[model samples]
Target: MKSSVIKIALILLGSYLIGCQQRPHADKLQNATTKKIIGYIAGWKGVDTSAVQAEKLTHVNYAFANVIDGMVTEGEGRFDQDKVNIQKLHSLKSRNPDLKILISIGGWTWSKGFSDAVLTDDSRKKFTDSAIAYLIRHDLDGLDFDWEYPGMQGDGNVFRAEDKENFVLMLKSVRQALDSLEKVTGKHYLNTIASAGFKSYLEVNDLGQAQQYLDFINIMTYDFVGPGTDTTAHHTNLFNPNLNGRSAAQAVFDHVEAGVPIEKLVMGMAFYGKSWKSVRPGNNGLYQPAVWNSTHPYRNIQGMVGQDGYVRYWDEDSKAPFLWNQSDSIFLSYEDPESIAAKAEFIKTHNLGGAMFWEYHEDSDDGELLNALFQSLRK
Candidate 1:
């Protein structure tokens, strides 16, 4: 009887240990929270957004699902997309009740309203109020301010003195609103922003103040360089003195030094490739005519064109992707899955917030990039 009793006690102790090990850590996401952050972005949910596929990938924690129309300056809005996205998001609640679906407003092209809206309290109120309504309508868990920048323009924007202070104020106001809603609903909501790549990207902004409001910030780390009117180096890569600025590993360091909490920073990855063509073949210098091409059709040295009448191709040496052609000799650079995995590891090494991607479609459907990221960086 004594021996049997001792064995039972041991068994109970072992079970307790196992349970303790399973407990969530400070940084380790709760099963539900983890599922919400490991999200994907398809186009708009109103369209065929592969919502089912996303659900299949339900282990993903956060879904910054589509609802652009709702944030629009006019007309139907992302509200048109809200019902469908929310329904889809609701389906995931059964499996991941804590999973968060954020409405990411603004994009490479959709940032025009941001500058105008944030310039005044009334417009800011209009934008934020509409945003809250949209979130309420669709049952979203948070909002991602993806404004390209307060003052940046196409080649990417330079910072302004006003942007430094006003930006933090804007974030604080949004956070206050979200917190108010949280108080009433007892539902957790996230406040976040998507920033740019320059080492001094947010130089004009106050990260310390911003961090107080933001849950975290997603740094748009890719597209460091792209073809526009000229060949340029952009995107993450081993530095070559021969190339240009846009994309460089150093940019990551830049943000960290700027006082952004490394723990609250999620390195953004790119799954696509930028292409370019050499004006002087075999010279390995100068590319032109940038095209948005992903699958490199020819060898790294070779090139192809799309219906848009622009040629595209890749560069192997940089370990970065790009597009270029003879006419324009424009060089574009981007990141692929392999580089993305490396970035994920970088995030892990720094113990940063984790990782985020620009959009879901840019990734090759195998989930290789994000999966590798999950494996490398998951807490």
Candidate 2:
């Protein structure tokens, strides 16, 4: 009888321990050893989606659905063109059933309208209604708001101090609308935002409130150093050892610390490179005074590698690569297979959501950068 009582007690204790065990958090979810791989397909790029290697991606966001006077415009002026492109994106599901296409609205060029759209309850309703109708009409799986910013006019958008709270109110309204439609259709719709990586941007908006409504926030980690800057540095470095400026890791921590769940943040990688000309030769033309030159798509850069006096060098501290053409006094900073792999490792190490790039057209036909991300994340 004593032995049987001891066995029963042990069983009860084991049951209690099992019941107390915690489930995995969203960020730490064990999703087949790889997180979601999202890629942006810029609408104006005129990319032929049929040529896209759809199976490599889990989600493709259609770029730049214009917002006009508080109304969501499916396309800026080329409505038919957008329809055709969206159709092509949806058709990719035949090849990869898991692929989801989302409509991204209010990019840098078109974000001006967002200020007025979310200003009032009535305006928010109009915008929310337009968004849902647009998604349903296009048969899209989700919506991504890429308003360059809220409560800021730097992107040629109107601003108000109230934008901070208004932004959250707008997102909540949209989420509620989407949920209502979902209940009727018995389908899920994802709602996300393309957020700025800078800490200043995070402070202006209520990300904690916004996060509750968003499926995830896509952090634009690239472009930290662009043509407007005076000095040269890695615009998308994973870690800033020297602390010259913003790093991807810093941006991730800022957002997560600001109340966004780690799993709800998707880091953005640039598929193109930012370049500078007339760079001083000191420090191998890095962090030197230089004039910002035009950006080079990875496809174009791939062709320039090891040619035209161009030589690529890797920075061990930043975990990024740069190209210097000593003959032309040109310096280029961008992501490559190695830097991208490092970023993938950062994502895995931090247990954050997977990687995303600017657009599919910027990559080589061989899909070099995309392949690197997919392979690295899989491991």
Model 1 residue 94 CA deviation (Å) reads 3.5
Best by TM-score: 2
TM-score of 1: 0.69
Model 2 compared with the native: what TM-score?
Answer: 0.91
1-379: candidate 1 lDDT, tens digit per residue: 9999999999999999988776634334432223223454643523334433443332232233322322433224544455565576567667645456776766656665556556567756666777677578667777887766665663253335566666777787778888899999998788887788775556656676787788887777766555453443445563334544554345556666777777777666665555555444433333333343333312222223343334444454544444444355544455554555555555544566666764555445465555655555553
Against the true structure, candidate 2 has what lDDT?
A: 0.87
- Candidate 2 residues 90-148, lDDT tens each? 88999999888999998888888888899999999999999998898899999999988
Question: For every model shown, what is its TM-score relative to the native structure?
Answer: 0.69, 0.91
lDDT of each: 0.56, 0.87
